[model samples]
Target: MPSGPEVLQAIDWRQPWLAGWREWGEPVAQAVADGLPLHEALNHRSAAPVRFVPQAALPPGEAYERYIFNSGLCPTREGLHDFFNGLCWMRFPRIKTRLNQLQAAEIAAAGVAPLRGPVRDALTVFDENAAFLLAPPPLWEALMGKDWQALFVALRPLWPQARLVLFGHALLEKLVYPRKPITAHVYLAPPAIDTIANLDAWLAADLGADKLAGKPFVPLPVLGVPGWWPENENFSFYDDSLVFRPRR
Candidate 1:
């Protein structure tokens, strides 16, 4: 593999929100530096390997979690989406595995539904457009609403610790095909995070509301988050007046 420092320098992050990914995704660069393709790099042989099964090869939903437990990977095909998903597995194995277990357990219990159960819905939401938000409890509801002021202005002090790591490929892909109503998957971080950025190494301890101020948050339409447009300007996806507007 290329020198670790070289790996860090090569992978360009589009936004600061993804600084965690940039900092933590050194393996991606090391693999690249060593001339490893995406799939090989991701599913590299380990004590536990994540299998990249073709869509046709996958069994029913009920067996999915069992399959993951047995094989340490759920089904995924090759593509940019699959590629990013692999990166997520490498970055957040525990969280990803837990999500799979929940999903598989839900499927095993209720089977697939046209509308889906709350558990499945929550999992899907997290998988699709969610951001793994590491912030305080006071910021959870506000951050969920994408309240910029509550997060960054009035509660500016939180920025020293507030972090948002994305786990959704749809949100990542939207770096190109931008969209809205993109919610942050806020997961309250514990003190362990102050030292390392390993999502796999995270300990889920909700940081409840301490003495913090509330502020009216400015609703910022999240699109073109960062690194999408070349100009490096503060732009919003809602700028396309015809495509998006306030619902009246």
Candidate 2:
């Protein structure tokens, strides 16, 4: 693995939001720099360097209060369990263009064969988190409208050990129904982050290898055409950021 500085440099870290994250994320970086194991820092979010603290490390009586989950208009509205599998359609044009930009020598240097159009398109939206926002209002009414508080109350018993942290633009749904009950268990963060540049880092920081190993970061089409509203796989919330992994 590359040193922290080298890893940071390999990617363009010029975004201003990342700067804000510095204060919050330092502890995380420090932990990685210190050679902490992956499982220890799996789901913790810190914007700076720090040591890892496993969930098991916490006092048995004291439950973990923080959980981060990104909620969205998944392909399957009700359970939406298989949503992750349908996300690849979002990576289109961009990945194709990126691949096309490579010179034959560059392709050889990269040690990967050029992809066929259909295959590229298939993989593009494969692991997408894009369609979440496109979910019909009826779906939002069913989920968020029921009130996050009620949902949490009912859902908590199923997973007693975990606290729920929702990661998505679903907070926007609150505006339509401000009276909706909010829950202590439900937390939200701005879903907009430039994913093109940060997908790798986001996975590195959020999911870690334990969760993301062998996974591919497929993009989603937030916007598409008629048959595929907000047409075009390239235009998506993913233009800013995305979550590419098994839906779980």
Candidate 3:
């Protein structure tokens, strides 16, 4: 595995999937390049509500979310996973805080168990693998229905009007080594949210325990998003049934 600095150096901040993160990521990357630790680099660049601390800051046996909730510190480790996680906190602080709040609440109510119960499970899933998509109803209908051909091919022109922003840090981390099978748990954003800031605020306000527990997300193959991967431009790309499964 590459060191954190190496991972930082390898990222192409200009990638469409990384939009809205360059402003924060570039400076943090430079700080790491200058020999700062990943957590310290994140601290140096962050104005978010939570402080970035070394992973050791998390006491052994304490729940991660519980610690963050109690201390307002995010324990971060070196690597693409935590690197993207820090970026998510920087870019979508409100949403991250809200998720942390919910997770901490669940931990408090039920204690950390082998099975996190439904609400905590959903929160973890969202934090690790969610994406926000703003598109026309037709695009959404096709996507939610798992009609990949119609979504990616028939409505291909409509992609110009759509915006898909990756929210899950794990999803972003996996894309560093792009694979056809990498997918996102997509949440639809209100069409009015035209900017990242607006989306952050809206999503933070929109998330609730009941809503999250329902797991209202549609699966989207990240590479299939128009313009995200060049190979996807070919109609044959969607024919990979393993990646683009039909609705049951």
Candidate 4:
């Protein structure tokens, strides 16, 4: 695996999806560049609810989420995946903690069976691939209805008013090699959530066991968000039906 500094060197850090993370990520990158391991760099910078620890610190047979819930220490490894995970914990501690709490509760109720049940599955999906979109009703309506033309073209002007903050660490890591088909499981942010801090706290309080199990998300191809990718400036870009599939 590449060292933390090498992984930091590979990220552009300017991607809009990474905007929320840049402030925290830059300092962590600098520490890694100066020879700290990824987990150590993250721990040093962490004022989060949970601490960052080496992956080996997790005892065998213990579930990752359970370990964090029980110990308040997130098992972290050195790579873009874990780097983003650690950054997410720092950036959105409340949301991350809520996810771990929900996951651990499910594990306690269900045990570590092969099938992770609906609630755990939904929580895992949100943790790995969710994005929070604070957009106008038109965009939200078109997106939920899977109306590509209306969303990307007819309502293109409205995108400037929208704020799509990437909350999933795995989603952040995937954007490193961005492609057309790369999508996010989008959750519409409540109105007036103009800042990341407000969004984090609101979302953490917003999540619940019953609500998450419903799988409330709309699929949005990340690059299709206006200004996110240059190629999307052309109207024909949404013509790729595979990436922007019509609602069934």
**CA RMSD per model (angstroms):** 8.1, 20.4, 1.1, 1.4
Clashing pairs in 3: none
Candidate 2 ranges beyond 4 A from true positions: 1-14, 17-25, 44-248
Ranked candidates, highest lDDT first: 3, 4, 1, 2
Model 4, poorest ten-residue lDDT window?
1-10
**Top candidate (lDDT):** 3
Off by over 4 Å in 1: 1-14, 22-38, 45-49, 59-71, 136-147, 176-183, 195-248
Candidate 3 local lDDT, 1-248, one digit each (tens):
46556788888877788877788888898888889999999988888899999999999999999999999999999888999899999889999999999998898888989998889889989999999989999999999899998999999999999988888998988887788999999999987787888899999999999999999999999899989899987889999999999999
Off by over 4 Å in 3: 1-3
Task: Count the clashes in each prediction.
Answer: 1, 41, 0, 0
Better of 2 and 3 by lDDT: 3
Once fitted onto the true fold, the runs of candidate 4 whose alpha carbons sit more than 4 angstroms away are 1-5
lDDT of each: 0.51, 0.26, 0.90, 0.89
Task: Score candidate 4 by lDDT.
Answer: 0.89
Report the lDDT tens digits of candidate 2 across residue range 58-140: 44442121110111111112111211111111212232223222222233344334452333332222222212221233322
